[model samples]
Target: MTTLLEARGLTADRPGDEGPVRVLDSVDLALESGTLTELVGPSGAGKTTLLLALARLLPDARGSLALDGVPAEEIDIPAWRMRVALLPQRPTMFAGTVAENLRVPWRLGVRSAESPPDDTALREALDRAGLSGVALERGATRLSVGQAARVALLRVLLTRPRVLLLDEPDASLDDASAEQVRRFTAEFVSGGGAAVRVSHARSDDAADRRVRLTGGRLEEVGRA
Candidate 1:
């Protein structure tokens, strides 16, 4: 398979009272098309930071990131963002109805207006995320965190990004909800898509490769 994403000598640092605080140091990763990779680590291990960097959501720091064999900096930010979507650990939802929140990405220009996904596709995506059509009419603030997470997943799916970045996506879910997320993620990658997920959950089966980050470095742990 072709390489969809690659990071070389990636490093990130933040200003501290005394000096620069290094979060990542010479971290490297490669993700192929149609694969799901997991990034597992303890808190503050730079898992989320790496995801952000790969998605081009983070400001320019050090090293290089390439998407579809092209350097990240060479692509337009908005266009790159459309090709790469990130679902943070705590995803934000609008105050409107569930459907409205799901539609926000399309309405905001992530997807082309000329070829928007149909209602059937949207409903199917929600169903795959373990949600029913009733969720569409419900108020976003009224749904529980787990439901919101599923809705967020559906929202991202609607955009059909080639590369997906998820950060602790299953953190607030119950057993059944987590299983739903796993199944959805698996199906997403099965369809010639690529994903990198950051999670501490040991039970997730969506990832084909597992990586561990510690002390500002990343190392491979397992391969599926």
Candidate 2:
């Protein structure tokens, strides 16, 4: 498999009342194309910190990150973020209709040149995310937690990121809804995208690799 994203000596720190708290300790990770990597660890184990470091979203994170073998320093941050999208646990809904919220990516500088998705395309994406009943004109803020999570996921999918950084995407979902989330993740991997998902539940879904984080250190648990 081709290496889609690589990280070496990744380190991160968080702000505390006393001083900076070390969250990650020189962690290294590599993501390959057409694979989904499951990240599991106890609470406060820095699993989410690692994902944030990988996505270059943490201001205190320091490391060497490369995408498709290109050094991160050479690539613009916005461009890198566009290719490597990070979806947090809490879904953020803009103050607008569903269609408008999904169209946010196109309005960003990174996707400015790309043609925005039509209503037909949006509806199809919603259907795939198990949100077909949601109307495009419906107020995005009114969606239930589960519904909002799927919509946020669909919003990320519409951007067509190469590497997806998902932080507990299925935590708020029920069994049926969680299954749909897993299916969407599988489809993304099968389509040649790489994903690093932080999941607490034991997944029956297929994943190429499993990594565990403990005390800011990473250990390989197994591989498919």
Model 2 TM-score on a 0 to 1 scale: 0.96
lDDT of 2 at 92: 96
Candidate 2's C-alpha runs over 4 A off are 202-204
Q: Which ten residues in a row have the lowest lDDT in candidate 1?
A: 109-118
lDDT of 1 at 79: 87
State each model's CA lDDT, in order. 0.84, 0.90
Per-residue lDDT tens digits for candidate 2, residues 1-224, read: 89999999988888889998788888889999999999999998898889888888888688799999999999999999999999998999999999999999998877778999999999999987889799999999999988898889999998999999999998888888888888988999999999999989756468889999987789899899
The C-alpha TM-scores of every prediction are 0.93, 0.96
- Residue 120's C-alpha lDDT in candidate 2? 97
lDDT (C-alpha) at residue 182 in model 1: 85
Tens digits of per-residue lDDT for model 1 on 49-74? 88888877766569998888999779
